[model samples]
Target chain A: MGTWVQTMLVIMLIHLTAGTPVWAVLGQAKASVEKDRAAMGGQVQSKLAPGYSVETITVVGMTIKEYVSLDGTVFAVTWKGTGVPNLRLLFDAYFDEYLDALTELQNKKPRLRRPLMLKTENLVIERSGHARNMWGRAFIPSHLPAMVSPKDIQ
Target chain B: MAYRAVVIACLWFVSACGSSGGGNGSAGPQPPNVLTVTVGGSSVCRIVNQLCTQVTICQPGTSTCQTISDILVDTGSIGVRIFGSVLSIPLQQEVESPGHPIGECVSFIDGSALWGSVQLADVVLAGEPAVTVPIHVIAPTFAGQSPSQNPCNSVVDSDPRTAGFNGILGIGLFTHDCGISCEINDNNNLYFSCVASTCGSIAAPLPTQVQNPVWLLPSDNNGVILTLPNVPAMGAPVLSGSVILGIGTASNNSPPPGISTFTTDQNGFLTTIYNGTTFAQSIIDTGSNGYFFPDSTLPLCPMPDQDFYCPSAAADLSAAIFGVNAGRATVPFQVANTANLLQTGNAVFNNLGGPSSSFDWGLPFFLGRVVFVGIEGQLSTLGTGPLYAF
Candidate 1:
């Protein structure tokens, strides 16, 4: 029985060690899985969302520098773009970072091993302040319209 | 349930953010770097045989119908999909003018069913008018049910405010809400269908139908353009201006220059290029949430055991734009992992972007470049010009 329990369930670790409330701990994890059921229209031991997939759109009226700072790893990025900014439509990066983040939590004690939702929207830009500010690609200059006509198609 | 409400409130906050900064006129007028797409070729779509319009699609006094003026134009989708919440009763017609309510369950890429009443509407574009068009009443509002959706990813987030745009007037080269293909299984599920303008289950083996809204409209059925300006490398901090809705043609449109260019695939798709990668048969879709691809150079998200092959992490890469007859351009950017991706956490995401998927650029990709889409038509009057510029 001891060997069997060790191989299959990790929840036992929480009850035996963390000395935490199983109901609240398991509740959040269940909520995450239930979301897939909600998506499937009904239930069938569903695990619909394997990972996080998100899209981010950052709108701006002024040029602002983006930087990331932390204790150990210093990931500093100075980005300024006149041409369309990279929306990073790739969901892969997010899933990787998020899943890694989740894996760490999942590996921990009982209450910590909960499923999560990767719900992040692009940082918002409320209104265009004014037209005085210019919009164009930073370095390229071919966008000049030649005032051509519909007859030019020939 | 209360927690769901809280989540919904948060979702609204996020949507408000999507529409704000981009609309501010603070940025000066610069011709948005336009990508000209050719719009000339012919595709066929059968009008739904029996579906009702605005009729029965009402919260009672909510008025199931509104003039075409009230409709909003959306690019995120290929064709038109009207919501039931906005229609007026007088405008609502009976299903097939005789039979039952046609119902359908639309599945977004996020994998969720938007079950609701389905009907048709008379669409008037430019000046012409179609008597009855199959318009979807997506919201359960007509069914007397409050909205219930995954708050964080609902369509409302696409447009936070209802200021100018109301219902969608999709004029993409294809259809919106891709009728059935996005479904996981069981073809005959009628999520959004019509028996006679009323509602019915979708026909068996749902078809990934992408109806072109312009074709359904009474006039200017040719094609459309989305023109805006280009932003510099250093992005603006605020929103820009109204997204110009037409090519510079008629009095309502502005024809700047260098816009008359394009090529077409008989399959109703256009040939496009990005970062030196040329995709010959790419559909002009606005409804997609992000740019998607599995280019060899870009990093791939390693979503564990998922079919999408999405990497769990975003890859940062730089590539040049190729295949433009006018001139060539080089640009550098990062590709992030989107949902339903492939792989397990970190292992797969470490590799460069997918070498599998045909490249795709979603709404985010449109933000900076002025893309021209060529729609197929008489090839004579409907000459190849990027019908869209942004």
Candidate 2:
């Protein structure tokens, strides 16, 4: 099969399998954070900070943090560990959008190998680090709490 | 022009290059311990500030050897990974049991991963004795598995053109890529056992995992000393340096007196105090192309180069680095507008930088410095392994 066809089929498969309960926590209700913690089999520790709450999950050499607004809406997610966590679970409905943006960025001319800083109309994702030690954060700018800033997510 | 004059003077007065310089002097010929490293200029590495070196790999114990160029000299990762397309010799595939071959998925901070089969080869660096060790041979279709099945769950580089280098020689602080973590946990998402057309996560024993070839060398196995000359603030079309194997094992690799030493965690992370905030996960990595740290004050470059900083003018900054052993050093660095630097058509810059969650002293930091990397558990003049000295 052609490479493009294969890529499309893979995307389809990812979309089909992305319907599990563990997905869609990024822009979902606060309850989805529990599903993510359960799916990842990690212990969740929530901390309240003025206008929002931060839910941290530590699992198998990786740490995942979920930021929820005062209204209980998940706003941003961050990860750091030996390897990248499953983005399909972290990005949820926005997973495909992330992949699409990445493909576009990778296809650019004068191809440079560096950290990724992906900014779309609604989401902003920044990933950096090397092997064995990696980290990144993603957030929906529109969903951020009034007093919370992007830098606060980290 | 001044930098060019300095280079010419160094060539004439070799001793003036200092003890860290890779000069054989009047002694016979080029030293066996020194491997010439270059950035740009005739190297296949097209990316700016990417350090490239030559590596020799042979089929285990045979005379069949192939010397590959454009192999990245990475201090942020472990083990040697080569693109299968660039490898000409047939290597022995590492097997899990009998018919099950071992496969690995190594992910970089750039969101790209390499998926391939584990193969054993006789790896050679500079004039060091060849070490027989397992290495990762990049093959996207290994074991009939598709890219989506990669344990990294990320896009895999299919060839050297897209990846920008033929392979990477990861001589980091760790001896093994995954180390004890992979040995004890099957869910580490690094090692896999391929049976037939499918691969599953597996807990690979330490011996079966890909190793840092430096650790397996008969001599000069302790660590390495990387030396590169300083570049002007604007940029340079190309730069040359040396990757001297072994630290204090030979006279040429010995550490100079009064050099500060900093011990790092198992994952090679130190702490950085920048802008009143403490970033405890800071690292000094040559693999990173530029200095990366969070600086809300610096504006980012426009699109295409948006990942890089684009200060209106040059911005001089400093950060305090604190090692786990209480070794403290304040480092001053610069950040220039990427738009202006790119206009120079130069491949190297001392002031190139970007934004990151933590401080990353990248290739730019190696300029004008002779950095020592002590491997884990190994002892040298700079103390024990898992330490950085400059």
Candidate 3:
């Protein structure tokens, strides 16, 4: 039943984006980049850090960054700009859990103006900013490598 | 372009007494000067801390009109938006170069989103006729668009039933929504043009895009003043107020000499310093229910109510609001436990607040005050466009 529930969760999230898992190969992340590039316009850019690398794909009005471990596994995603990117595509399977946590938060405190900080057991999603200058990031906490801190994703 | 303050006040008093329920009225003597806004009046859709008003939308160039009630009045955003599910009139859709229907994905500060198509309508607010402006008719399935194709994260599903409000009327201090961003780039994703069943992002020209209906009025188009009576610390079951149109144009709407005015940036952001920390992008948004700003000392309600600040007792706090022109005014507010406040039948409270990075003076801040929002690039006695005065 536990596996069934997990599978059901993945199925619901697949309705959003491809049910991509964390710690996936760099090749799969590139495929997502290609798909996103085809869907959303703009050039794909990259930046190398000490223990990890970030692939930034710039769309028409926003840029999305995918943090990859030194071992080439995509671990996290972050985005900011005038327009909001397709969050469904950015977080993939993790988006469902994020939505659940967000629903819980909103139900508790409806009509809040704060930037959202949704933390589940395995994922942490933080989004802030008013219209036109919106920004947010999502990551799988358990999948992060030893050297990479959560702040590094941003 | 100013009218006598006494004349405005008389008209406001007469109109307040005349209009009992909601209906479509004219733009003659009424001047659209005063509109009654109710907070938490609907029983079935008992949305807490909600500020709502009645909006009468008409078929362009025709008398065929429908008055929509429970429309959420929001200052956090700009544009007169309605849900297609509640719209009875068949308004014309705005199309792009390729003859595709224009669609929009409006995202909110809380991470929720509204997906819809842009349509042309004559919006009548109070007694003003904002003629032939682009308004968003929120239809998630517009042009047979599927849920997967929609860009927004589906929190309320863009449905009024689930969202607990009829629609949103965003009259923030901006002339246009998304502004030059949607005009210059197609990839912004806020505006889209649909060919057949597939909608793709497209650059919407300024004239054709959604506009703040308040800015397009023939007369008294400068700005608006939202005046709400003070609610008790324990909260009230229902709250009533008025959104007076124009600033300094009429006596009742004029900014008093003692009133503090804060100028804003192009994005309508002002500086708010809380706990000695400056948040340059703060805004006075009536759309937000609580006074939202992060504070480490205040405790949060357990489990579900954790989104709001819930001290054991009410906490009095002070914050300085700064303008881009170096003007500043300090404001004192309070925050109480959300769980305790919810137990009461009252829908309005002046002391409710929550945790947020930006200092959001929500509906709670409007109680016992008259807040003015001057339109961008428009001239008023208060000064020029894009100013907030209280």
Ranking by TM-score: 2, 3, 1
Off by over 4 Å in 2: A1-24, A29-41, A46-53, A69-72, B1-28, B146-149
True contacts kept of each: 0.00, 0.40, 0.52
DockQ of each: 0.02, 0.35, 0.35
Best by TM-score: 2
Task: List runs of model 1 lying over 4 Å from the truth.
Answer: A1-154, B1-73, B86-90, B94-98, B122-132, B141-167, B175-213, B216-219, B232-284, B295-358, B374-390
Residue pairs whose backbone atoms clash in candidate 2: A24-A92
Supply the DockQ value of model 2.
0.35
Which tens-of-lDDT digit does each residue in A88-153 have in candidate 3? 666666667777777766655354445677788768777765555667787877778788887577
The alpha-carbon lDDT assigned to residue B345 of candidate 1 equals 18
TM-score of chain B of each: 0.50, 0.92, 0.91
> lDDT of all predictions, in order shown?
0.30, 0.80, 0.74
Output the TM-score of candidate 1. Answer: 0.41
In angstroms, what RMSD does candidate 3 have relative to the true structure? Answer: 7.9
lDDT of 1 by residue, B87-141 (tens): 4333343242234444544332222224445554444332222324455555543
